[model samples]
Structure formats: C-alpha cells, structure tokens
Target: MDQRAAIPVTLPRDNPTQSYWQLEPDEIADLRSTSSLPDKADTVIIGSGITGAAVAFNLLSNGARDVVMLEARQACSGATGRNGGHTKAASYRSFLGHQKDHGTAMAAKIARMELANIRAVHAFARDHGIKCDSTPCDTVDVVYEAAQWELDQKAVKAMQDAMPDDDAAKYTLHSREDVWEKFFCGRGGDESVCGGVSYEAGSLSAYQFGVGVLKLCLAKGLNLHTNTPALNLEKLEGGGWKVETPRGVITAGKVVLATNGYTASVWKRFQGVIVPLRGHVTAQRPGLDMPKEGLPGTYSFIYEGGYDYMIPRPKGSKFEGDIVIGGALAKAPADGLEEYGTTDDTAFNEVIMKSLDECLRKYFGDNWGADNSEGRIRKSWTGIMGFSPDGFPFVGEMPGEKDLWVSTSFQGHGMVLCWMCARALVTMMGDGDEKELDAWFPEIFKINEQRLRLTFRGRLS
Candidate 1:
C-alpha cells in the first residue's frame, strides 16, 4: 500500500491531550446556536479554529447574514489552541528557497505579508478589547550551529535587500558574544552559541483570541455548532453545496473549508496534497534559579536539522513566568517522518517528550537550577498541522468546484497566515476586486490547475 494513502487523516479525535491554553474554557467553548442543525444557510464554514472565526468575522461584518460554523470538537480545540502561542514569523529561514523558486519580489512580498498579518492580529485584538494577553515583543532566533548561523546571515541580508526599507529596519543581527551575554546570561560557549537575529514579534493566547472573535461574531448573529463534524460534501445541481453532518445536512450557497489537518477527511481530492503532521508542545515552570520575571521575550533555538520555539507567560497572568516550548522533530523517530500523515493528538511521542524536558536545562545550563514542586513540565500535548507539498498554503476557490472555497494547509504557521488568508478568501468569495487584494496577498497562494497538478505530483513522488 502507498504510505501516504495508508495513513489516515481522519476527523479531529475526541478527548485530545490537554493543552495549556485550553485549561480555562471560554464561555463559547461548547456553544450550539440552535436545538438542531439549520437546514440552510448563506454560507457554511467547517472547522471552528482561528480560520473559521476570521472567515465568519469577515462575512458577517460585510453584511453577509445567515452564516453557520461547524466544529468537530469544542470550539478552538485544534492546533490554534494547542500551539506555542507566538505570532513570530521566521520568514528569513525560507527566504532563499522562496527567492530561488519564485523570485526576489515574490519572496519579499511573502515576508511583508507575514509581518502585516502579525500586526493585523494585534490591532484587531486591541481594537476589540479582546483581553487575550496579546503583547508585542522582540523575538530572537538564536543559532546553535556555526554553519547554519552563516547561512542565516546571508538569508537575512538577502531578505533585507529585497524588502522595503521600513520593513528591513525591523531586523537586527547580533554577534556570538552579544547573544551569549544578552540571551543566555553569559552561559553558553563557542560550541553551543553562534550569534542571533532579533525582530519584532508577538505572543498571545490563541485560544482566547479565537474564542473572543467568535463571541463577537455571535453577537452579530452568527450561528455556531460545536461537536458537529462535517462528514462529507456533495455538489448541488443548480448551485452551492450540501454539507452532510452527523446531525443533519445543510444546503448552503457557499461552503468554506477551514479545516486544516483534517481537510482531507471531507475533501478527498486533497488527501495526498495536504498531509497531516503531528506536533508536540509543553508548558514548563521556570526553575528555582531562573529569573522570577521570566525571559524578556519569545525565542527560537535554531540548529542544523530543526528548531524549538518558546514564549513566556505574561508576568501578571496565572501561569506567569512559565515557559511554553515546542518543536523537537529532529530528535523524533525518523526526524519526524513518523509524525507525518497522522491526525491523532490524543497521545504523544515519548522520545520528543524527553527531549522537551531536557531542552531548557541544556540551553540555560546550571542557571536553570532544580525543578519546582510541580516539577519541570506543567503540561504536555500534541496537535495536528496541515503541510502542503510546497510551503505555501492553498487559498481561494478550488478549480472546477464552484462555490466551494478553502483556506488551509498552513504548515504550522497559521498564526501569521490564517487571519489575512481568511480575509482574502472572504473577499474573493464576495467578488471583491482582486487587484486590491493583489497589493498585499501573494498570488502564489491562489489555487489553480497548475498548482494542483504540481502538488499531486510532488506528493506521489
């Protein structure tokens, strides 16, 4: 059997491993607008994560009424809730590859879009007073390998040259000594520390942000149904689609699939194109010797094969000073190949868990000190992320499928991509001017016949 087809990318599983962000359930966590499923709607959105919330927000805010959203589990209980909450976009890491494939102008556009998306998210939160602890801070990418550090320097310089002068000014490079003294408290040596790059980034409670957005949409008369999985989709003869769910079927003029990792489950055409990859995360208490106020900002420890990203809980928050870290794919079996094409988030890999436990101790050295009363890790969990054959996400309408749209395959960078992607998608759905969207959104993200062919070929090969 083909390995990709053999792995099941089913619907979101029940009783998923608890994530640190979802500990305090929101009021709309299990919201069901009506006693039964609605028979019809102007628009139906599958998957109630950030993408779904953003799509509903855009639709309702633009005078589109009768929009319904469906969730397989509790609202915001997918990757958005389980991820390490950082709106940091490490675009430089892929700048060289993007430029080589698409060209300098497109690469620069991609980087700018990411930064703009981060700002939009923060601005939206502040404007709505959605108290999700959204904070803007400087995020650093600390290099641990000399060779990788050199490559990153070149990538950053190339990105800076391609981007606008104002955008380029946000990045700053540091020497190994500066990194050691500033970030590591003068701990790491030559072998462990190799310079760093700092840029404007942010950290927030994604679950809270998503739920808050949903609450606003609900106030505007958006219908939400939790624990309502979209089992399948069928095309209507005259127009629109019939979305089949366990409870009932909804005939909507438009159907929007915001399902990320489990998209293939309902849309079989994306089976191989959008592979599901399981990711792990942990919330750890700062050691006794660590600073009571926690580290200054968010961080990413970059090495040769993989990188680990982290964010500290806000000082006045309940889990103040606690570090939320994730990504140890290099240490996982087969360098994370074992995690691909899997949608199970109920359990985690022991090898990755062990590496996560040792991560802070290794980086902070003796200053990490002994564990607290509750030990190092307060909670650990897994989430499923959708990965496209190419790094870019698949947005806009599906070819040959009228009224059916999609905004998924975020490749675990949903924080920096979903909001804007959702906005652009809604614009296209409403027949808004494409040239206006073209000014900010990347054209490569649009779904076309050529992209679909290439994606299918790449998956099979």
Candidate 2:
C-alpha cells in the first residue's frame, strides 16, 4: 500500500504530551550512563522503551558487554509510558481470523505464544524486584452488540474444540443473560449488562517496567544516552554501521531498531510497512461515594462499532483509586482510520473522549460521576502506536540489511510482544541458530523480502 500519501511518521516530537503514568518521574528518566557517546560498542540499541531495555538486559544477562542504547526523548517517554497499562493477549475474539490466515498449526502456536508472553511479564517483574504495580488479573471481554456476542460465543466453542488440551482454552464464557451475574456480580446495578469471555491477563506500569529493567542493565555496563536521537545511519567501510546524532556519531557492530512507532524515521523502506498510529488514554479516580473495592477486574467494552479497554490501578498503590482506560477511536472524527494513520499524539480528541465517558457511565450507572461523588475523569492523553499491515510485529533482522535488526511494529500490542521478542532476538544474535529461535518465536513475526513484497492491508482495532 502506498501509505506515503497518509500522515508520515517522524521522530519523537520534542515536548510531547505528558502522561498520567509519568507524573512522578523516575531518577533515570533522563539518565545518561556515560558522559558522552561511546566511540564504539559491540551492540547499539535504538529507542529506550521496553524493547530496547529488554534487548540490553538480555545481552548483559547472556554475558555480552559493551552495549549502548540511544533514545530520542526521555527513557520510557514514548508509547510505553503513555499506554493504558494492560498486557492482554489475543483470545477467541481474533482466533477465527488468525486460523484462516495462517492455518491451524501457526494459529495455535500464536495463541500459546501470547499466553507465554503474558506469563513472562509477571515472572520478569517478580525476578527483578520491579515495583511497577504489576498485577495478575482476569480480563472480561464485554460485547454489547447481540450479533457480535453470538459470533464470539461460536468462536469460543470452536477454540475449545480445537485446543481442548491447552490450559488457556478453558476460558469461562458468559452469555448475555448471565453477563451481569458473571461480570458485575449485581453490584453496578442494571446498567452493567455486558459480557462475553473472561480470560487470564495482567496489568502493570509500563513506564516503571521499562525504567526498572533499564536500571539493572545500566548496572551491568550498558551505556544509555537519552535525549539523543539517531538522525542518520550509514554503513561503515568496514563491516559495522555509523549512527549520526546531534551529540556525535557512534559506530557499532550491530544495531537494533527498538523504535516502535517512529521506526520509519530511521529506516525509510518501512514507510508503509510499519505505520504510526495515534491512540488516547484517560485516567480517573474514584470519588467518595464509590465503594473501595471498586470494579472487580480489567474490562474491554466490545461494542459493534467501537471498543475500549480499561485496567484499574491496584489498591493502596500510588494511584490507588484511579483507573486507566483507552480506546473508542471508532468515535473519532474520521472513521478512526485517519486517527490511526496519523503520527501526531500531542493532545486528546474530544469526540473519542466523550464516547469513552459515555461508555463508563453506561456500564457503571448514573451514580458513576454524579456530581464527582462517584468517579471523575482526571485527564486524557494520547500516544503513538505502530500498526503493522499484517497484524503482527516485524521482528528479526531487516530483509536485506545485514546486522541491522528490528523489533518494532507490534500493532499496538507492544506490551505482550516486546519482552519475548527482545529475548529471542538476543538469543538469535548470540548464536545464528534458526531452530533455537524457532522454538521461541513464531515464523509470522520474522521480517524477510517475501513478506515485504506482499501488499499492505490496514489492520486497526
């Protein structure tokens, strides 16, 4: 697809909008491990979001030193910091389409792979002692549309029939008749009447996750330079590459592009393949009238023409009584496509914000925001996500660019994809063993000339 005509993706804008998660900044938010850019390094990772931090951490864990990471803005200042704080994987909602596109074998592989990614996130948090509010929770996919609910029910049955032995296959599905009882437990009143499937999921502060792991990597001699963008890249006469920046040029043996939405800025060939998509998220705190228990678990309002996801902050945490919700782009001005294709995320769209507000009120009832006595909307912010044409992230080495690896374009599912892909990418780099990598990564995620030749088909929502 010739996305060149659409809004072009560019470097992270200076003074980009701040997010609720980044309200209390971390010490390493703008840390530079070294006084200046290193003259040379064995590996240089770009974009210090979760992906870059994972790459650097895995490299150090595997005994590889002399690594450096460059970020255009503050650490974890991009989508990772601006996300809605949910790490949900695909369930029956997208199972049928995936099954048809990649056959049952790859489809099943993808399903299990996502589950593993979610588990890996929890394990990482526990192992590293990262207090990122990482919480294990169940996600209720609530479909308000009758037709879509029926279709979801059928898909759930099909998945159970196909993957009978898989542990995750036994997702508890609630029919429309029992949605209130199963989901709200009759607490939120008659207004709470939407439910479809409830599955295992997790939530965490993505900003803290990125920065916490990055601190561990820095202790192991990882040179990180924030506020430094890789403006231009060129192949050195020898075998490595030279990356130019306002600070200075740095040479590295291998370069990894962890710049999720802004990937096309450094690699022009990815102009259309890895498209930038803007999304909005809002944070709200419960008022005095609401119960302290609040909503039971995370939620996804699956409407016929729109959807919104929400993850409530853990109790007693810094943002204790707050909830972070994002989506409803379908209510945006331009069919949500124009909003998705755009690169700007400096402000929130009022139309979508209004829709999200209405959704919360409808689900929670009239007492939700009754004179700020229940829960009031605090703030709304936006962030850019990379939407892959094929609905999969572009991982592994660039098609023809040797030693140039990429782990971007996650289709707005970066939380579940970044850590696992980074681990597998580090393994592949340490040893050129395809069989080993095949065990960790699915074939659909690899980048190659064949996949690049295929036409682009927009895959949003």
Candidate 3:
C-alpha cells in the first residue's frame, strides 16, 4: 500500500482475535441504551473507548444532557481493551527530542501533563470504586544496548533538571548490577543487559475502567449505542451535524471524533495525518522454575529500534503470575511496516508470537525451565493504534470546522494522554475558562492550520 495516498480507512473487522484482557466481556459490552437510535441528540461521540468514555463522563457530570455515543464493535473492545494493561509514562525517553523540537518549557509541560494524567486515571478509578484491579507500582525500562543506556542516563538527567525536585525524584537510574539484583534475579549476569531506569507507574484493566465510566455516564442520562459504526458525516448549513450510521442517522448540535485509528475513515482530512498501525500482544504463563509470586512490577525491555513491555496480572486473580507481554515489531516483516495503514485485527502475525516466545527464554535463561502442562503461551491478539507524524495528539476543534472536535492520534500512548485530552476538549466545547486550560493543557496538542499543513506536506512529499 502507498501509505502517502489518501486511502479511506476501513471499519473494525468482525470476529477480531480475542484479547486476553477481554476474555470476560463487561456487562455493558454490547449495551444499547435504547431500542432505537435517537432521532437527534445534543452531542454525538464517535467511538466508545477510553477517550469517548472520558468525554461522556465529563459532559454528563457537568450537566450536559442529550449526549449519545456510537461504537463500531463491542463497547470498550478497541485499543483500550487490547493494550498491554499499563498506565506508564516513560517521558524521560523522549525528553531531549521534545526539548529540541519544542522549547524547554513546552517539553517540561508535556512531561508533567503525562504524570498528571496517570494520577487522574487512578484517582477516578479509586474514587468511583471501580474494581478494575488498579494497582500503583514502579516500572522499569531495561536497556539492552550500551549506547542507548548512556543516552537514557543523559535524558533522565535532562528531564530531572527541567522539573521540580519532587517530580524529579520519581525517576531513578539503575546500573546493570542493580537491575539484576532488584528485578531480574534469574538473569544470571547476562552481559547483554546494560542498565535500567525505574519510575512511578501503574497497571489496570483499561476495558473495565472505561466500562465503569460509561456506566456512570449512562446513569447520568447519556445514550450509548454499540455495534453501530458512523459511516459518514454531513454538516448542516444551519449548524450541527448529521452522523450516518448502519442502524440510523442521528443529528446532533455537536460531534466529537474519539475514533483514534479509525479517525481517517470518517474524516478525509486525517487520512495520512493520523495513520493506523497494527500492534500485537500476548498473555504467557510463567515457566515452572520462574518465580511463583510473579515479577516485581511493570517492565519495558528497550532495544535499538523497538521494545517489548510486560505487566503481571494482579496476585490472586484468575490469571495470577501470568505476564501480559506485547511488541515484537522489530522481528516482524519490514520491521513491522507491513502493519501500517491496516485496520484488520481478526488475525495476528505468527512471527511476532515466535519472537515473544524466544524473548522470554532469552531474558529469563534457566529460570524459564520447561513449559507447564497448560503451555507457555496462553493467547495472542492484535490492535491498531493511531500514529501522528508530529508525535502529538490533535485536540480541540479541527481548524475551520465549526462545532466539530477531535481528540485522537495518541501514538500508542493513549493511556497517558487520552483522559486529560478528552477533558480539555470538552472544557473548550463548553466554553469553559480558556485561561485555566492554557495553564494546565499543553498548547502543542491543540489543532491548528500550521500543524495540518506540515503533516500534509510531509505525507505528499
């Protein structure tokens, strides 16, 4: 496929590979608030993942009635349901690059916002008593290359130097010896392991959290329609929009596209800008000789061109001690370029599965003894993520598009950016205090003609 070409994205495929995190569907998974689609609504949100859930929750909590949400598949079954179950923000890894592209202040602002977003997600889950198995824990980025390890040290230092002491203290650099002793006790002095950095992070069932929020919104008079994809959008001359769907059409005063990877399918302007990339993940049972209590915390095995992230299922849960691992793009064909611009998730690449299987044995060595009776690998699946050329989400209203708003292109870091981005977009839609938003939200995330033009030029060049 010519990625630069303006090819319209396809809708979510039916019978997608079953995700480990979604093995047990939520009660609201196939929910339809009413028997029939409403003729009109005050607000219509496209997509029913975390972004849409956050937007609807904020709108309803603020007394906005007549809100309707549309989902293309089972509710919360998109990227939010198929991700590796992490709420981590490895901001230091991108500190220098962000500082060079944006200014020091803007870079610092983005880092802080990411941290704040993680805290907000946990707080909401806790405050609402959402039983998503949310857990606060430390995360380690284990570096494999010496050169990359050196760069990581400098980036961490730069990030710390730019932030306040309290926030800076959240990150700590660890030597190879330290990583082996503290986290990977079974590695047995692997010379290939360089070092690592640890920081505050978390893990939770994103599907559960999103469904909990949507349940709250439903109680607040919000309408939700699942298995109903928005096929096309028409703008009314008098104001509002006409959202065409397979079931029926719904006219709304305002429309919000939280579609992420599927955004280009409905909005032609985002065709090349918000490119779709397929990612694979798996749930594996620990070896018989491995630690029965599970690993210490969330981890990212960082290498030259790609990384694999893992999060342990909470202790005492049905799948306790099982590790949810994902990302082996480097081993895939063309370094995974074959995944770009694809929306199908019905199947996953066998190469990625083989790479993940080998990775476990390579990293764990002897500790990863023989597989148990149940087998080592439990399940594998694929999900699509939206990639922005500029590495920032497009928030706020689309340039020159009246009453139409967007909060997509999270670049696979939606867990750390979606909540706040959705909140900021809704605040702007409600004509809330602009000064307050300016003080907290990163200005770089807002949509503007300059960003649109730059991305278009890069794609067509």
**lDDT: the better of candidates 1 and 2:** 1
lDDT (CA) per prediction: 0.87, 0.80, 0.86
| Sequence-dependent TM-score of model 2 | 0.94
Tens-digit lDDT track for model 2 on 170-255? Answer: 68878665666555422354343455688899899999988999999999988989999999889887888999999999999999
For candidate 3, write residues 350-419 as lDDT tens digits.
Answer: 8987898768777766667788788888988999888776888999998888989999988889999999
TM-score of each: 0.96, 0.94, 0.96
Please say which candidate is ahead in lDDT: 1 or 3: 1
TM-score of 1: 0.96
Model 3 — TM-score against the truth? 0.96
Indicate the worst ten consecutive residues by lDDT in candidate 3: 452-461
Q: How much is the lDDT of residue 358 in candidate 3?
A: 67
Once superposed on the true structure, which residue ranges of model 2 sit more than 4 Å away at CA? 1-5, 185-194, 287-289, 366-375
Off by over 4 Å in 3: 1-7, 185-190, 456-461
Each prediction's RMSD over C-alphas, in Å, is 2.1, 2.2, 2.2
Sort the predicted structures by lDDT, highest score first.
1, 3, 2
